[model samples]
Target chain A: MSLAEVAKNPAGTGQKLKLQHLGMVYGQDAESVPVLEDINLDVSDGEFVCIVGPSGCGKSTLLNVMAGFLPATAGTVTIDGEVVTGPDPRRILVFQERGVFPWLTVEGNIGFGLSKLTREERRQRIAHYVQAVRLQGFEHVYPSDLSGGMKQRLQVARALAVNPDILYLDEPFGALDFVTRVIMRGELHRIWQTERRTILFVTHDIDEAVQLADRVVVLSSRPARIQDILTIDIPHPRNISSPRYLQLRDDFFFWRNPVAGRDSSGPSSQQQPCWRYGISPFSGRPPRSFRRRLA
Target chain B: MKLPARFRPVLFIVLLLVGWQVAIDRHPAQILPGPIAVASGIVDLLRHGILFKYIVASLFRVTWGFSLAALLGIPLGLMLGWFQRGEMAFYPLIQIFRPISPLAWIPIAILWFGVGDSAAIFLIFVGCFFPMLLIAMTAVRNIPSIYINAGRNFGLSSSEFVTRVLYPAVIPQLLVGLRITLGIAWLVVVAAEMISVNSGLGFLIVDARNAGNRYDLVVAGMVIIGIIGLLLDLAMRSLENVKSFHWSSSEE
Candidate 1:
């Protein structure tokens, strides 16, 4: 269904978050730079949506606008038919870097939003989340003592502790190594499955987007607008080497760079996909061999 | 060949004492007392009980002055940092007054407080206040916006934000500031005592010099001051090793 059709019905019907004609501009008038333009999207309850675009394409800006950290220059964001005027605890934005409080222990970070609960209740809640995130043994350890993946998990645990209806993640695993990033993706998927919270994740890695998101929203470069929205029909725990996965991944590449896709489809395509050669399609530069072939 | 790191400081001190003894071997004790003469003078003051009284007087002034500055300056700084208009309005005044040495305030302090513990304390207060204020202000300004956003997203009330987020975020930086400002307070107290109060270590130095050229006692007062300053710094440095503050230093 179209986004406009989804917005016509208020969020209480089925939609978790509704954005209509969302636009963001930094500065005023003549000197103003438009960062995001004419963005319309709707996420259903318990759905996972990933936004992917080139670097500096204002994907983070869109997430920030939705999270109510920045007011949209135009249009509105509504959750469950309520207009989001400012940041609310019900919708938590997990930042890109290690957002877990450095000064707080793992337990303390999880219990941060639970100040209203009684002491015993808070302790139990903290313990529950610590176990949920597999940080049980490191309850008293601070974020600095944690590895990159552990810190991100702590951040996710902190967000989950508040029982937010929606979680907005901005390139959360962008800093992790390749192995850790894959591991964190699986961990996040497992947590989301159990928690069933609506997640809007923004990333540049198409592989990550396909692996984690139910619907991937592609954005143009600066002054970002939706380029395409592809739905992944595959089930959870998808085998990366499966033909369906490869087809979808290659389709995403071709959609982004049709000319390059056509060039690679010549006799050289019989070899192997560039991804198998450890080349990143999202890196904005093709492999040397591919470049040589094109030349 | 290579000394252990812990003993290096001790070795340096021993060499310093040897150099001092050699430099002063040909001079009369009245001209410049050697370390041995200063040691005897310290023992003599200890026997007379005057050294204890002087040290206590100096410490009492510093405690009052530094405590008052911290209590008042920290909150003021947090407010100024949190509120942009307040900072823009008052920061210029702080900058203008900061460069004036605490010693320069001596005459005015004496006039206001009438040449006693109060005058010495007032000068120390002036010495310590600005550094604390600036440090607290800078600490508040430097807190990562992510932390503030996180705190607000969790629906922290204004008071809760200050108590939980702002206060804890500023602590590691503030502790370092406090240590430096405390050193400044110590230095100002001695100077203030020399001119106004007649009952501190600073007074002992001036008094010893004037009364029959007791150079040994003057050197002894200097030694005591140095030792006390070192101890105060060591105490403050220990606070930095606290587990909660380990996040501020990346080495952890």
Candidate 2:
């Protein structure tokens, strides 16, 4: 989805957000540093767009700009024909950290931003999303009691309950263990299939990008610019270890290992799509340290 | 396996009281109050209701002053820390003011706000504000950018982003900051009352000292302060425990 498409109609179906040439910079005066550059992006009505990139890439920056938490140093970001200067209830962000209010239970967290609906309507919406996320028994549970995967699921349910125009996720599964991550991936896809609301996902996981996005927008390393845009045609249940998947993954990581055999104190261009790639499943043998994490 | 871990502390308190009673038996009643004398003094104060009155007065001061500080401090701290440019503008001032002791502000507070309730209250606010703000800002600053990013994906507006998204995410640290501020508030309460207050527990001790430093009343007053502090701390602790569990299930 491009800003041009979003602007032409202004009100585009369930489509609620649009960004054009959004760029972000931190600091002021002499030390001002650019974080995102020349970012042209869009979310078609109910389309799930996953942004994948190398480490330190501006993926999160792009999402923050869309959410209106950070204003783009240049370029325009419009949502439903309105320009964004700050956060709105329309676009909600689901962070990796527990975003649930400590004082509010799972049910309350899901109901956090629901001022638009009547209390009864809000409760019904909460109930629906709670059931949708498989958190029926734990609705009264405090965020502290849930496991990592369960917490993320609750966040998803919470965001869904509010019924925002778009849902933004920043590596929501990046911190989970491999098993939990796999489980979250499945749960996420299931939720997305039902809601079909526009989702702008930022992840360092190539497989996660490939699995979730209709089109994966790969970003470059720091001062991140768009590197490549790959359209993944494979449907759900795509195998990551399959030849085509591996080949795409290889290309996603630049198709050549900068440090295949060479070892150096420097970065060695060995940077993976995400932190997990340090284990390099392509090596055929999991490094001893990586094996310890499995244990 | 069922033995109480707290048994030793209870035993220790009992033995210390017994030793006090025994010493008082050997010493003069007027000079050294036995455990019984202090217990009776406590009951007498309760019966007279001065103890309860002082408790209310002190609780009011602590709650209001600390609340005022928290209201202003937390938001300002979060703003300074969340935005890089704001941090650059405000951090130097925070660093400079953070180390100044709250008690040191007593003279200035009296001069600015006058001696009665305002002086005492200003001291309490200052006592808690700097430290609470400092910790809150640090917490906000250290929050990974990922949390803010998550707020955007949900289509949350700026206000919601801060209050709904960013606020809850930094809550674990906010609780830590609250713990620190509560302690600071308690510390300031007595010292703040000491300057001019005529009715708090601090005044009780000072008035007792003026009446020839009557050990029994002095000891009684100190005990009252300690007990109330302990109870308040316990309340804050339980609040945190309940909140921590709630936070886990919702946001984790």
Task: Identify the leading candidate in terms of lDDT.
Answer: 1
| Each candidate's DockQ | 0.65, 0.33
Task: Return the interface RMSD of the candidates, in order shown, one decimal each.
Answer: 1.6, 4.9
lDDT of 1 at B34: 93
Model 2 chain A: ten consecutive residues of lowest lDDT: A257-266
Task: Give each prediction's root-mean-square deviation over alpha carbons.
Answer: 5.1, 7.7
lDDT of each: 0.86, 0.75
lDDT per residue for candidate 1 within A193-222, as digits (tens), equals 899888999988879998998788878777
Superposed model 1: Cα runs more than 4 Å off: A1-13, A256-295, B1-5, B27-31, B250-252
List, residue by residue over A12-73, the lDDT tens digit for candidate 2: 56555666777778899899888788877655676777887766777887887787777789
Best by DockQ: 1
Each candidate's fnat, listed in order, reads 0.60, 0.55
Candidate 2, superposed: residue stretches over 4 Å from native: A1-34, A37-46, A76-90, A239-243, A253-279, A283-295, B1-3, B19-213, B235-252
Q: Write the per-residue lDDT of candidate 2 for residues B103-196, one digit (tens) a residue.
A: 8898899889887888888999998898878887898877665555545545667787777767766777777678778888888888888885
